[model samples]
Target: MKDKILIAGGYGNVGQVICSYLAEKFPGKIIAAGRNYEKADNFSKTTGGAVLPMKLDVAENHENSSLLDEVLLVVMCLDQKDTRFIEACIRRGIHYIDITASYKLLSDIEAMAGLAEQNGSTAVLSVGIAPGITNILVKHCKQRLGILEEAYINLLLGLGDEHGKAAIEWTVDNINTTFDVVENGNLQKVRSFEDGKESFFSEKLGKRMAYRFDFTDQHVLPRTLNIKTVSTRLCFDSVIFTRFFAILKKLGVLNLLKLKNFRRLFVKVFENFRLGSDIFAVAVDAIGEKEGKRAEYHCSIIGHKEGIITGKVAGLVAEKIYNGAYASGVFHIEQLFEPEEILKELEENIEIRCS
Candidate 1:
């Protein structure tokens, strides 16, 4: 029997993509585990039993599960409110990958670096779009500009795209919260969606008014790359929706989105609405000194179906880890893989622009 690769939340919007991709790549080695046994079973049936369904809840204690004995890796497709599941993975020496963009959860995982190293296990975080692809683009730009002084990342998401529930909830919850960011070599607090800037992504994406958003890249890049300043901004493709949110943010009405019921309602509304295209874009603006002269570099990627793109990135990372491409420790996507190589792999799925 082959080593089992368990995917938590395997029936979810993003998890289903990961499950399907891995099942095709590895064939019968994928186990779709989640809280809903019926949904998992149904999905497995749809896959012609290539993906085995199993019931596993991260909320409960997993240290004693027999399933852990047969699993080689755990791909977390859902949000974890705590670190117990990660600790359990480390204790059992299971390789892990998470697509979460939560700064606090990532920090908690980073705290387990020593334990992961000691157990000869690997954990890869920041495995999705904003933090994943954005981080890789920043690394590329930083390398292009020899002495990197500052970097800015801009992300534009299509309002019509079918986002996952967890992702929608995360955005709504953070829309009004304040977070710390590195600015001019000093830490500063900024309200999410309150501060705005204009950026040109590409001729196709055009210029967009992006707002300061609390993405994990802004927190991880400064210390990892030794950069002086970094910031991340977000905007939607719809001009009217963008301006509407900006107005709500200015009026302090965005805080109402922090409520669970309101967030759920917003997610439902967003999932049902399809006013814009399904295209999403990411751009990086880097400024530094090279040859005693100032230099700048810009890179952008435009694609459709972000959920699938994120799943493909996670699946590729998991395959590399399974093949012993990464050392035993906790790492971000950019830390373990070269941006150029990753971009090459994704060339088929996305349009890349560099200048």
Candidate 2:
């Protein structure tokens, strides 16, 4: 009976949180899978057998794996270089949820919508905080502001949170890259950490200067929500930290991140440094028409431990996919879920305000 839930990279920081959350509800049916058997086993021991450990590498082919045969759903916590593993899961009619924020990779998987539908598999992308909650909040704004035209997403991440290597690596890698964002119904070239814009987060966070960041939410929302213009900006909780990156970008010093050693050093510094509060804030501003007049909608959420909120959101979405029947195909979180539904589940962990 394809009853097991396989979580790739299950022993890692965010994965363990998801594993523990699901294990409590589905006990003994959650499998924490990774290439490191010892680490998976060690993490499983902490669950008191509620979760099982499995030695499975997502990078390898899974077509012939007997373990995959018993898995009904696969929640990915690791970043993949290609979509072969995802194709394998869909080919077997398994439900899929990914926490990755990679726009290029997500577009590739989206191209396989026909394949997923044919195989009766449902795949949910943009399942983490920025893309996850940010996506949901924008959708809510659209709902409130009828005839939505443009939306701007601003993210504030804390330095004190325990960021995983992948997250830090991704941050460093995109420090000096160029990406496209929809503007006035056309794509415009934008550089990371450049073109600072001040955005109000909350009473506690105040207004901080946010810069262009290549978060996938901006890319997906334009097509998924049919919005003409969408942009996502990023900033740190600390005012000084946010300005430092912008200054580096303006002076072209951020280009040094292209080097492996410099990238590694920056990643290490972020991992060890704990200067700001362990808080994450996401805010969205929507412009459109309500009752034939120009109107604007605003929404925001503030929370502690970005990774935990991300894991909890993934776990909640997974539970829905596990127990309910969703349309089989590739879809972003907002396309299939209401923001109120998700925010309700996360109310205790997050502070949300909408207007």
Candidate 3:
């Protein structure tokens, strides 16, 4: 029997893609587990039994030692507030991977590094677009320039793309919250979507307005990479919608989005309406000193759908971990994998450019 890989929330929008990708690669070793066993079972049938369906509610079964008996790795596609699930994985020596962008949750997971090392379990955090690819790009830039003084990550999401409920809720919840960021080597507080700047990408993406947001990359990069300053901003493909959110943030009315009813309404609207191209792009700019002279490097990747790209990244990382590429410890994606290597593997799904 092959080692089984469990994907929590395996029936979700992003998880579906992950299941298909890994099932094709590993064949009969994938288990799709979620709160809804019916949906998981139905979805498994679509995979031609390549994926096995299992019932797993993290909140309830987290401490069940037998839950992960035959599972060698667990890919978390859902958002979890408590670290108990991660603790359980570490206790059972099951390697873990999460695609969450939440700083607080990631910080808690990081706190368990010693225990993971002791148990010979590895956990990879920051495994998605902003924190995953963005962090990797920063590492690429730093390698090119020798030393990085400042870094800026610009994210452009396609308003026309279909995003999951969890993704939408995460955006709505953070729309009004304020967070700290390092600017010019000084820490400062900035409200989400409050500060704005114009960024230029490829001709297809062109120039767009990006606003400051509390992304996990901004928090983890400076400390991990020893960079003096790192900032991350977001912008939608639709300028009108981007400006609308910015105005609401300035007026202190963005908090209304936190209302469950309003958030659901917005999610529905986003799902039903298609305002722009379904292509998302991420660009990174790094300013540093190389060869005793000031220099800059820019790198970017453009992909069709955000969710699919995110799933592909997570799947790639899981494959690496299962193949014994990573050491037993908690690590961010950038710390464990090389940017060029990952981009090469994902070339079929994304276009990468650097200058």
Candidate 4:
């Protein structure tokens, strides 16, 4: 059976990578969907084969009765705000893969597991680098150690890389959120970047400092992995932004960044300007008693472009859905696939550098 992959944010940066990937690999079976029909149509034409143009707004009339009637798999590249979209897919017995960064959103989706099983659909969340690969690494350490005590997941983004406007918007909108943690084992109100704490990353994006930043995995991974403590941090490829943000955080002025006007100011100043290298990194530091021996697994994945990495993970998950390599229920990427299996695929060139 030809796997029909439907990408929701098909015209956006990461979605294009995912759509192009599935189109090339699966052939004559892919849908580029978004709210913008012109862009979606343009992307479909650009691909010229296997890529179909479809317009569907998840926020409005999310019922996929006619919009997503026969798609075998749906790779969501958009920020998933609600479970309606996931529920629509579940109602149709379609597999759902999301690359979103929302913990509340996943909690909402998890509430629908019974409905999902009744419909024979699986909603897989956290299918991107930070939450995606980070979860896999956690699984690996948990398996090796048999019992995990704590973990620190650090994420780094390339400020110089041309990220999608949507992604940039998401980042800035949530920038001043009541999140960010400064200490371990406790969730306190430490403004994002207020902590000058540093985490020197491994090769491919050498030595950099990371500050406490909120990503969904840090909130969900501990309970999901049965670990006592887990914290995630963030940094950029350029020291300039990191240092500046650190200061702004101290002054409590990062909240200004949440304004549209300031974001416009930022776009005008930094959009076309590549101040640093196009590199991304993820580091996992795990510690616990492994086989009754205390051990730690410190690993990282570095890449120049997230689009490439996101597309590959999306594709691999698509392949799994196509091959029925999934259990019948709602699950996160870590829950759906073992860390060893996921790491094997990543090592085999699914867009991740395992070390």
Model number with the top lDDT: 2
Task: Output the worst ten-in-a-row residue range by lDDT, candidate 3.
Answer: 60-69
Candidate 1 residue-wise lDDT, 288-312, digit = tens: 9878899988889999999999998
Candidate 3 clashes between residue pairs 3 or more apart in a chain or in different chains: none
Residue 345 CA displacement from its true place in model 2, Å? 0.1
What lDDT score goes with residue 56 in model 4? Answer: 81
Runs of candidate 2 exceeding 4 Å displacement: none
- Residue 312 deviation, candidate 1, in Å? 0.5
lDDT of 1 at 324: 66
Tens digits of per-residue lDDT for model 4 on 279-320?
A: 788877778887778887666766678767777887778777
Candidate 4: segments with Cα more than 4 A from true spot: 1-3, 62-64, 180-190, 203-206, 267-270, 348-355
Error of 4 at 131 (Å): 1.2
lDDT string, candidate 2, 1-355, tens digits: 9999999999999999999999988999999999999999999999999999999988888877787988999999999999999999999999999999888889999999999999999999999897899999998998898788999999999999999999998888888889999998999999988888888898988888899999999999999999999999999988998898788889988888878898888888999989898999998988999999999998999999999999999999999999999999999999889988899999999999887
Candidate 3 ranges with C-alpha deviation above 4 Å: none
Better of 1 and 4 by lDDT: 1
| All-Cα superposition RMSD per candidate | 1.3, 0.7, 1.4, 2.7
Ranking by TM-score: 2, 1, 3, 4
TM-score between candidate 3 and the true structure = 0.96
